[model samples]
Target: MKIAITSVGQDLESKIDARFGRAKWFIVIDTETNQHQVISNEHNLNISQGAGIQTAENISRHNVEAVITGNCGPKAFTTLNSAGIKVYSAVDGTVAEVLEKFKNGKLKQAGGANVEGHWA
Candidate 1:
């Protein structure tokens, strides 16, 4: 399984970014191999609108099975859901820490959007 974790920086030690759409980076990890890649989300940060949807589309192309982030807005949540990607929100700490929690089934899958659209 490949999971994408929103991050403030490009590595496992980086703190988790609270905003899903405008997060600075996404650390996508392949659970089976323990390998990962960093995807920059800078382009979405300054968008006037549709950041959430755009970000969702961007990550979907990476084929991540799930997304672990601090928060997810309505549009992004729906988009991810439509693409068969699960969203896990309200997560904190470093990317490595959350990855362990997810691997251990300690993280809860979000049922729907935790925040409204246009959330920064």
Candidate 2:
């Protein structure tokens, strides 16, 4: 499975980004080969609205199987779901920690969007 995590920085250790479309970068991890790649999101962060739409489109384009992020809006959730991609929100803590939970199936699917728009 291919999973993508929104990150403030390119490294896997970077904090999970709150903003989906305007995030600095997305760390794409291939679960099978364990290969990690970084992709830049060049949308204008200042005036960007409906970030969820763009985010969903981006994830769909990448053929991502899952998106483990801090938050996802309504549009993003619907778009991802229609595209057959599961969106896992409210995933706080380090990237490595979350990944471990995911691998072990310890992290169950979450509901309810957070107020801070991330993993608060």
Candidate 3:
């Protein structure tokens, strides 16, 4: 499975970013081979509006199967759901730690957005 974790930096050792839409980077890891890639979310970081939706759309293009993040808003959640991507919210710790938790089935899938839209 391909999982994308919101990260504060480019590497797995980097801490997980608490804000999904405004996260600095996305660490996309393929569970099968342990290969990964980093995607920057710089464009959405300073956007005044539509950041969540835009971020969601951008992630969808990467073909990630799941997203692990600290928070998610309704619009972004809806967009991801429509694209057939699962969301695991309210997560913390380093990107590597979170990835391990996910692989071990320790994380819970979020049923809906955990926070309101326009969250910083």
> Best candidate per lDDT, number?
1
How far out, in Å, is residue 12 in model 2? 1.3
Q: Please provide, for model 2 over 20-66, each residue's C-alpha lDDT reduced to its tens digit, 9 standing for 90 to 100.
A: 65676888888878788887776635544666767778778887888
Q: Enumerate clash totals for all models, in the order shown.
A: 0, 0, 0
Cα RMSD to the true fold for all candidates: 1.5, 3.6, 1.5
Task: Write model 3 residue lDDT over 27-72, tens digit each, in one string.
Answer: 9999999999999999999998888899999999999999999999
Per-candidate TM equals 0.97, 0.84, 0.97
Question: Could you tell me the TM-score of candidate 3?
Answer: 0.97
Global local distance difference test of model 2: 0.74
* Residue range with the least summed lDDT across 10 consecutive positions in model 2: 111-120
lDDT of 1 at 17: 99
lDDT ranking from best candidate downward:
1, 3, 2
User: What local lDDT does model 2 show for residue 58?
Assistant: 73
Higher-ranked by TM-score: 1 or 2 = 1
